[model samples]
Target: MSAQDIARMDTGEIVEYEPVTPMELEFMIRELGARLENAVPVLKELWAARYSAERALIEEKAKAVLRSDARTITEKRAEADLATMTFRRDFDAAKETLHAAEELQKALASRLMGLQNINKVLGHAYGASR
Candidate 1:
């Protein structure tokens, strides 16, 4: 069964029984392909446009959190350094802070990677559909 036949076969009966013309088949394929191709950009645009408000709010929250974290990390690092300066007694505290920072860095990196994967999937869907 051709692409067009499947498409028109809603009730398991071929409606266009006049022998599927080449032009008809091609037209159906192209039309469906175009629709699929256009869907990706449309979806992306929708995602971007729809997320504007939520994204803005998230951004504001993220900025505030980031600022707070920056201050905290700085203070912790300084404290760690000072403690280390006095003696090696505070080595554990300093190491813990460094480890926390590393964990946070890893989380952010993973988030970025996830976004990249989403974009790649969108691209692939767009291409395949087209």
Candidate 2:
């Protein structure tokens, strides 16, 4: 997509992003990085609330499944018993939450790295200008 499109696109919507010019890219990267660096912790808090809500629901369902399995286990160890039907469901949901959070963290980290790299470029740019 075009640079304008890249500028507008959120990280999730990114199809592909690569710098066209080192100097210009550095500027853009620095700007974006600085913004993200400031926002990372806030975004993390948001994610925590979102995922906690989701996990709560999943955990309830998982508990129900566990109770059911506990009641059923002594009679027979069926597919459901070995399957971790309850725990697995909860685990999967939690895993997804964690994975999403980690992705966000990585994105923020990338932005910070970009900012640092751009700062170096900016220093040179100003030096040259002087």
Candidate 3:
């Protein structure tokens, strides 16, 4: 009997067991065994499908993490590039200033040498006249 039928039966008195032939008992056992055997492949397929879906989800999550890391790396590289460019510009300006200072120093040294030569010539001329 089906579980629903058994549940709907009155609970006033215990039911008496009905006797069946040995052949009928054997047939029922074989039928139930066959039904269980038929269900095994279906259950296996369902389990495999569930496993595949879980693996796909894990792979997708990994891909998303990798994409995020790539974006972060790109941004960091851009920042580093900008910092390097700024440093190069400052270095170039400082180099130009240093060059200008060196040129001024050379000009001052030449002027001082010319003044000294003029002073020596005047001293010799005054000594000769005295």
Top-TM-score structure, candidate number: 2
What is the lDDT ranking, best to worst? 2, 1, 3
Root-mean-square deviation of candidate 3 = 52.4
Q: Which candidate is the best by lDDT?
A: 2
Q: Where in model 2 is the C-alpha error above 4 Å?
A: 1-15, 18-87
TM-score of each: 0.31, 0.44, 0.37
What lDDT tens digits, residue by residue, belong to model 2 across residues 103-127? 7557656755765676678689979
List candidate 3 stretches off by more than 4 Å.
1-83
Q: Model 1: clashing residue pairs?
A: none
Model 1 TM-score, all chains together: 0.31
List the candidate 1 regions with Cα displacement exceeding 4 Å. 1-89
Report the Cα lDDT for residue 126, model 1.
68
* Residue 113 C-alpha lDDT in model 3: 49
Query: What C-alpha lDDT values do all the predictions have?
Result: 0.46, 0.58, 0.45
For TM-score, candidate 1 versus 2, the one ahead is 2
**Which residue pairs collide in model 3, if any?**
none
Ranking by TM-score: 2, 3, 1
